[model samples]
Target chain A: MKIARHLIAAAALAAAASPAFADASTEAFVEDNANEVLESLNDPSLSRDERTALFSRYMDEFADIEAVSRFVIGKYANRFTPEEFERFQAAFKKYALAVYENELDAYRGNEVIVEGSTDRTPRDSIVDTKIPRADGQEMSVRWRVLKRNDGYQVVDVALNVNGNLIWLAIEQQAQFLSLLDRTNGSVDALINRIERMTRDVVAGRR
Target chain B: MLCFGVTDRPPYVDIYLFIEVLALKAGQAAHICCLQHTEVIMKTVVSALIALTTLTACATTQDTTDTASGVSDPFEGFNRNVYAFNEAVDKAAIEPVARGYRAVVPEPARDGVHNVLTNIRQPVVFANSMLQGNAQASADTFGRFLINSTIGVAGIFDVASTLGVTEHNEDFGQTLGVWGVEPGPFLVLPLLGPSNFRDTFGIATDRALDPLTWTEFESDPDLDDHIAVGRTVLGLIDTRARLIEPIETLRSQPEPYIALRRNYSSQREAAIRNGETEADPYQDLPDFDVYDEESAEGTGAGDQ
Candidate 1:
């Protein structure tokens, strides 16, 4: 039983630590969605409706919404009632949508090049990439879209200053959990603080 | 041996006191960031600082002999129970949902959906390695971030083979290894699933590196019906997906869970990071120049 707990933690550690793998993962989707993706990328100007449509579809297709949700819930997950948990998820999602919605908007004009992705082969797999900068020169900017059966999604990205964002996610999850544990056995307080920050930002108080 | 000196801290759990101190420092760093994922950076940087020193100091011949010759094989009895429980989870819950998903969404559609979501995660994944002090992995993560966010359309990593960059795995368990922590024993979490104290700590440590943890909090009302269930359900699916194949390669015993634990321990410790995979699809990606969108595009955009 004790060992059971240990291995569960191992599984969690494995699940938590390793980024989930995808197979034939890179090329199939890109090849299939080439036109839809190309259309989305080529049109620099998208109506708010179009962007929202893309965002919604993209969210369903690529966001790892579950992992993100689990992270948002934090340790309090063990403590929360189902209703409370639902509330927590709702709040988290709204915060994310509100945040990234604007972010996608900023990328409206820059057309993305659909660099082809390779399959999950043994020796070599391709990194399908292209720079999104409008002027398109000497900008330390590029996007790697790995494909799978569903479609394509971005794994790592350089958002201006911070280069390695995904690795940062791992670091953040590890650090935050410790703090939450050190605190009053709940991520409630942290969630409140995040909410406060989000409200302040939305209100232009940041 | 370096004991935690606190029985209350959990037994057989020998994370260096320096790490305990570093964990505290990491928490404090998170406290300071009050902005983004700097908390994770703080923990990774601090842990790396300690790991580099500790690994070197522990590199002496005698210490090396202990690690090389230690027969404890910490994971001896733990993996059996946990692997069984994880299997139970797959049989009961995950498979059905995945089967449903497969039926509802054609395979191509399923992959597309997964790709789109995975891309958004590029930023998060890139930062995860930096916390481990993996310079090259971090660089590749950065390159992946750029290519995914830009070319792949808002953060999905498709350009794997092109840039001669290969995905180097990292997680809490792996991080524990870098810090010279032993795997100790395997255990299954009640609803959560397989782990050890070290890996549990690694799990805890890895959280600090999660971008979503620092940025978006998931309290939205829309995801109510399926989003919430979908996440965990898909998580289990993903879990089953990754482990199922690997399991076949291992010698499965009557106690499958225990076997899994032992296998992971051997595989993780023995694996070393470095050496880019051959053939690069991203080789054609044009030269990159740094562009700080958060700063130039608008300050406090994220905060807003």
Candidate 2:
């Protein structure tokens, strides 16, 4: 149990402390969406609910929530029954959407610029972007863009810390797995935790 | 030993008294800047003043962009140098010993050591939790300490966690943050690595909170020193062993200093918020940096 906690923390710490590179189109995809999001956040015409609705629409269009859900569950993905996986994926999507919605609220009106990118594969790239704070300092926000048959979808957000890539999906995966470990790999337990987390986010308690 | 004939009072009382004096100094330091400016420059000036002796190791920079990554790294030149020095030391001395410790000690044994180390710190955690006005965390810490110390056989096993009283970390640094003390300038101590002005004082307060710091043995006067030293060394080895992969990953980064600075800020922010407002993706993770509670200093470890 201790090892599990440490390994997950290490993964998160490692990711937080690492950095990576991305491709051109990937960078454009992330940059355009990020700027648009900022524009929406800064627009005084839009009500809070309206902005949240737009954010949800953007997430639905830009994020591959299904692929990320499966990846986050790690080995347990194979173990879950088809029905359980479906239920888990739905719960996870709701949780992810709520989390991003809450997180995005804090970065209203911040200017996002694509610094550079590195394409690890033909279909995958890590785009490095910066959100300039009020103090003229830039906060690194790296997007992991993946090319789908339809178009490019964001799979993860890497907040570079200590030169490490703190990937959003990977961090969540550790948390999910840790919960599963404690609950003896019960799918229902994970679902419950995700649902609770989502509720917390929606209620502004998280 | 120096307190032998200086006072008829117990030696441990003198240690606590000394800590109280230092605490007074820290309070004064806190009053000077953290309470006034609530901005960057004043805090930096104060931190620089107090830590002047260690400043010789860091190259001073006049850049106004101290909070470049939204983190006040006023002494980045010094921090980077010390970071490099710590890496070299870890690579040369700590890393190899940690590797050896990992090779010799099984995972289960190491976990036992980790649990025991954590159990030992519960008192301090409990104290901070109470200070932070978190009744639940305070109760949980107390329960964990009582249960682990007894049923778990001096915390060789985490029976408290099994009983569903999960552990949470609360150091004096976090306590201070909760108390509205702004985290001052980002600092990288020679061996201690990443920290800030407010947390620096928090570290001292935490040590003062720990019973081990003031505990003494009448049968063998030197026993406390031996225990403290042994615990510090063992903790360093254990933490290094857990962080071998992560540190290597950090080394592979193009700009490690920037990465560390940004991440440290985020991590500290998350800790202070107690997982609210800031998403704590690593809440269950062990206190990688907090091993510095004693004289121990090293990076974190946990393999995937």
Candidate 3:
């Protein structure tokens, strides 16, 4: 009976401490990763090509490219066979790398300050951050981080768009799903579209 | 069993045997849960818009405190309720109609309609640009109107853009901001979305500046009324259609209210500053008209 009481007490204590731990760890994860990204961007020594490559490496390490690729397609993810899914995810990673290259370059010299964090679920957390501009203004950014067996992976980024709070993944879901819906749920169509977009970014057509 | 029919699912859903695979994964369940919480999520958006609108209405009357997002929203309670009302109306009526509009109208036709609508607003934009003494923007606005109106066939083709004249959005509110007038409290007017005290006055002035507000066609006075009402209705639908994805995506967020407030305020600030507020990653991307053909020409998968 004593052992049972001790076990219960231990379990209760662990549960009680879990959320605070999650918040702290999640905040730290974003701060470290974001600073790492900004460091590469702010590095005067690196050429544009070198910085972009470094940024791609950081995305590979910090972002769950596979999971995010899957998430963006939403329920239609099952439409792809293993080979097709692999193809799509690979193409998605390349597209994301290109998009983010342009994205991070805009913040080349800005500082990322992690404001705070909130645990939405036991495994899901959001880290709030701000990058103050040189002109006395600031931009708000939030990371939706999810915990996995390996470690934390960034699933989505939330930011303001025309006065609306939009999650990058969900926004992509809407866009991709709309295209898929129109193309009769063709994974190949999506893969091709993404590849063309990647080409455009690489070639500076957009 | 939350079984939304294939036709019934919102535009955000995949709509292709989605439910069959939905039960197979935890992630899918979470996405479904977000859809289930639509009304609750939208309440937050409503509150933010209302707060901004109320703030705008009372800018001269009340001493409003600035929120962390830099918006002064003094009447949050009243704003939230009004926002809720607006969201309910939007979901039940406006969005569905917009979706239907997207469905029946071909992409080119819709683009033409959007172009025409934008062209109609150029006179007002030009007025505000002149008010702010922005010579370049004024010239651009005037050139766009003159070119798009005649050569572009009543602004249906956006020939001005193709000619490299470009386009811009300027309003009396931004003119006030340029004059160093404060935004004064946030507000959310019912059915009009977000505003503030300065913007409310700006809205009124813009309305007065509109040629349609007072123009009486010598040929047909009744035609003028019809054109005015048609412009209002079509403009609302076009704007709503463009926003469905962004607003739907907003509902999936963890803190929609705060997100809306912060973002809305940030965007307004950016707009007031002529979009010189730090670099927006999503800015250079194409507009969120997913069904359009030329949308594929953009650099990224989505605007957001």
Candidate 4:
């Protein structure tokens, strides 16, 4: 009876180990969104404003902006009131969208090929990709996807720029930390700074 | 030996005293008092202290024997001092220059320079690949050099990559590792960061084998010096600029020294394995999927 039970357990383990049973769904999710962003950038009919709006919408759909904002705020997260936090989150999303929109505009004839996904945590997966440039140079990118109640959302994008892994969230965290330091660690100061930046982005000042 | 001699001296002295008393009596006692009492006591105390210290040192050595054997850094004390010096140089000079370079040069221009530099080093890489008996990689590297030099406009653009010839960055150090040469003692060279004894030799060999080192420019000493200095400075700036973000991240880790050491060792090991080992399972994943925006948005809205 014990032997039979052991055999059953081994069979179940083998079934789970199969490639088809791995996290293909999550990998597909990240790749699909990445391709959409690339395709939207390539669309000729869309005006700059239209393209920016479409990219923002895509970011909102795929990215957990609130989570990223809270994470970047880091240790100072507890300083904000409920209303202040909400405002900060909204402003952060706009600022992030503007930054990404500008960055993506540089993509001319690059192709994003998703390599695979690795489960970093039970609810998080890091999807790897290679962006082949027109000149034959290749860049690596990793998308950090979080499994929410509804589905997967991208929380961070890490680009291997010149062999250096530059994670967006971590970079933002450092920026926020320095900004807070410069403002005497005041949440109001940070909020005002973010608000001003968001306004500048909306006005196309930067 | 001195301590033992001191401890045994009292018995010998007593016997000598007894013989003296019988032979010379009280008349010669004053003459024999030349041996100072204070000097004898001081010698005994110093010898005793020395013996105690020797015992303590022995115990300490025994306690550290296990750790000493497990670790490979025989020159750790010297290496750490060198590491500190390198860190200071990087913070003061190298990092600031790299930052200034990044701020001044546009990304596209910087990448072009980087490509040109890499293309120039193809001959060295090809030679190492040949040494390692990797004919396919050697052919690819040679092909890349030829194509980029002609069609790619002096390698300012990587036209060879578009033609399906990817880069293989083989070096003499990696070739030596592939040939079963053990990585000798870990060393922290001043301004060079982490390296090993084997790699130090490898660097020397590679430099000697580089075709550029034996060029006709050597006949014109001034031109040779100019070329050498220019290449070194450009290469240093390019590498330091590329490493800015990664080094910052490494510095933020809890134990930067241990982190860097482990990273360097593991990366070298992986290079030697040539992606054959399953040391990193993530390297074997399939190509990424591309999704449509409408369906993704619908699902996302439903989830929220």
i-RMSD of all predictions? 18.4, 19.4, 16.8, 29.6
lDDT of 3 at B257: 39
- Model 1 Cα lDDT, one tens digit per residue, B242-274: 233233322112223322332233333433222
DockQ winner between 1 and 3, please give it: 3
Docking class of 2: incorrect
- For model 2, how does the per-residue alpha-carbon lDDT over B1-304 read when each residue is reduced to its tens digit? 0111122211211212222222222222221112221223234444645665576456354442323234565566667677888889988898999889988998899999878877887888899899999999999999999999999999999999899996777878878889888887777755455677777677656666778878889999999877676666666676556655445434422234554554565566666676453343333322212322344321111111
Superposed Cα deviation of residue B67, candidate 3 (Å): 3.6
| Candidate 2 local lDDT, residue A68 | 77
Between prediction 1 and prediction 3, the one with superior lDDT is: 3
Q: Tell me the deviation in Å of residue B60 in model 3.
A: 17
Ranking by lDDT: 3, 2, 4, 1
Q: List the residue pairs that clash in candidate 4.
A: A32-B290, A32-B291, A114-B288
lDDT tens digits, residue span B1-304, model 3: 2223323322222211121121111111111112222233245445555655555565454433432235666676676677788889988999999899988998799889878988887888888889999999999999999999999999998999998996777878778888999877666666665666776566656766777667789988688767766776787777667655556534533233333444455555566667563444333322222222322332233211
User: How many pairs collide in each candidate, listed in order?
Assistant: 152, 22, 15, 3
* lDDT (Cα, 0-100) at B128 in candidate 4: 88
Error of 4 at B37 (Å): 69
* Cα-based lDDT at residue A100, candidate 2: 74
Worst 10 residues of 3 chain B by lDDT: B23-32
